[model samples]
Target: MQQRFYDQVPAVVLGYDNALEAYRSDKFASFPVQPDPGGVIMAQNGVWGYYGATPTAAAAQSTGSNTGLVVAVVGGVLIVLLGGAWLISRRRGARAEDRE
Candidate 1:
């Protein structure tokens, strides 16, 4: 059914704010209407969820925290240095054996 196809559409993807802004820009014209259903996200007392045909910003899932990104970079650098030292040691040992 047509309704099922619409169920997959995200409101932002369909240009919700853009449409409203465009319609409001023309003061002399009546706002263009969207008869099709859409979803929206909202929060009630900090309990957030999506409703209707629009998804709320707080509703669409958020992955890992960004606060620890600096730590991750530092850890990665230490790992690379350790790996480089191991590689140099292996090469030096091979060269010493060749001289014998």
Candidate 2:
């Protein structure tokens, strides 16, 4: 509903529901348009970039997908190792009790 400009081109903020239609009507209609799950619409010079709900804020954030993946893997390995250690300790405790 808000009017904005990019590179001197007039534009508006489009909701996800109407983004497709608006995009189709633009000069960049020939370009492939896809819906952004982040709920943002950026259009200028026949090209669109989606930044999700907070367009300005999202644009500044880094996805960090690769970094996230690495962290998750390392965390999983640590969990498994700790669990194994706990089980070994419990088994040893049981053996010591039986000997007593």
Candidate 3:
């Protein structure tokens, strides 16, 4: 049923300040009405997330530079290297114990 589908969908509410910012943007044109300044903006599309009253300068900088992807790649490489080193050490320790 339609009610069941809606009940299972995730949603979020944006505070008035953030709602106003989203309302003014062309990107958020799907919003049906002009949200009240003192009220909340409910997600009609059943999407779940948060948005601040205004985009932060740090977010803008990081997005344009693809910093998150770079950081993730570096972190992943570090984890793999550490895991390999740990495995090698464990194997060496086991061999030493076997020989004693």
- How high is the CA lDDT of each candidate model? 0.52, 0.56, 0.57
For model 1, residues 1-100, the per-residue Cα lDDT tens digits are 4566569754424322523222222222222123323322232233233122343344455756886898999999999999999999999999999999
State residue 99's C-alpha deviation in candidate 2, in Å.
Answer: 0.9
Per-residue lDDT, model 1, residue 97, is: 100
Which is better, 2 or 3, measured by TM-score? 3
Report the alpha-carbon TM-score of model 2 versus the true structure: 0.36
Distance from true position, residue 94, model 2, in Å? Answer: 0.4
Model 1 worst lDDT run, 10 consecutive residues: 23-32
Using TM-score as the measure, which candidate wins? 3
TM-scores across all candidates?
0.34, 0.36, 0.37
Q: 100, model 2: CA deviation in Å?
A: 1.1
Candidate 2: list runs displaced more than 4 Å: 1-65
Model 1 spans with C-alpha error above 4 angstroms: 1-66
